[model samples]
Target: MCTWFYAEKATLSPIITKAQQLPLTDTIMNTMARSAAMSGNIRPTDMAAVFAPNKQGNIAVFPMIWGFTVDASPKPLINCRIETADRKPVWKDSWFRRRCVIPASWYYEWGIPPSEVGYHNA
Candidate 1:
């Protein structure tokens, strides 16, 4: 499962502003600063950049906490398998109706060997 994702302000700024035409106001800079404070390792409950549809149905950038809350879990849950997302009660609605994209330069998955991981400077 993907437990963490990376985002850099320098890389995302262009996409957020030039391509998406969104203004990089002070509020957005603050959000970017928070992401940087984590060294781009955005885990569950952290403020992460997400691209989701606004009320106008146009894609917009948002700083969102990166997980879902469920009574079944003691903490927020972050991973949902695509195959089971539509079938699972906790993820069904979000899978079908309220989908959003979490922007990342890359992701980190647990249990993988260092040699096989993306960070390995092979």
Candidate 2:
């Protein structure tokens, strides 16, 4: 499960600033630049940066709440197994209707144990 990830503020700002030059994307990109300077570890339910298109069709980069609620478990869904998404009613409609891109500079792997801490690798 991709429970934790990171975003690079250094490169992200400049990139967004440049991309904002395109028509219809200036406002959203500028907004993203103002608050996108987030670095270090991000956990489930935290506000993390994601890139997605709004109803207007302009690409928007903003911080959104991670994970979605599910009735099967008390914990929020932080990951999805793509292969079975079509058969799952909870994720089917969303998987088909919505599209999102999660930007992460790095991700952590916990091969040792669930409780033990793990380090982020490039």
Candidate 3:
């Protein structure tokens, strides 16, 4: 489950302006600027900010941080099982306090095959 998500530009402008006044580096500032510039116009996937309110009631917008994934760990966490998530250590904190929602027109799910499969075969 996503404990936080980015809001639409109309809802995020004021928050973005406030974030600009903070003591952030040039890169951070630039990214925020870019995100604000693209807000409401681009696909959500292209936005750079994490549009969620923090503990202080302020929006927790931040620059995109990069990470890597390994082929060995192929399965990705696209969704969390809401039923048992609260009991899990990794997601308990976010579930309790920082819960967030991502608005979408539709969502996609894939069906599993009964036999072995590979990228090429699929």
Q: Indicate which candidate wins on TM-score.
A: 1
Please, what are the lDDT tens digits per residue for candidate 1 over residues 4-103?
6666656676543432333433454466443323224667766665788989999977656667877888788876788899999899987888888977
Q: What's the TM-score of every candidate structure?
A: 0.66, 0.63, 0.37
Model 2 off-target regions past 4 Å?
14-37, 71-73, 111-122
Q: RMSD of candidate 2 to the true fold?
A: 7.2
Q: Give me candidate 2's TM-score against the actual structure.
A: 0.63
Local accuracy by lDDT, each model: 0.63, 0.59, 0.43
Better of 1 and 2 by lDDT: 1
**Least accurate 10 contiguous residues by lDDT in model 3:** 112-121
lDDT of 1 at 89: 89
Give the C-alpha lDDT of model 3. Answer: 0.43
Model 1 superposed RMSD (Cα): 5.3
- List candidate 1 segments past 4 Å from native: 15-39, 111-122
TM accuracy, model 3: 0.37
Best by lDDT: 1
Screening candidate 1 with a backbone cut-off below 3 angstroms (N, C-alpha, C), the clashing residue pairs are none
- Where is model 2 poorest over a 10-residue stretch in terms of lDDT? 111-120
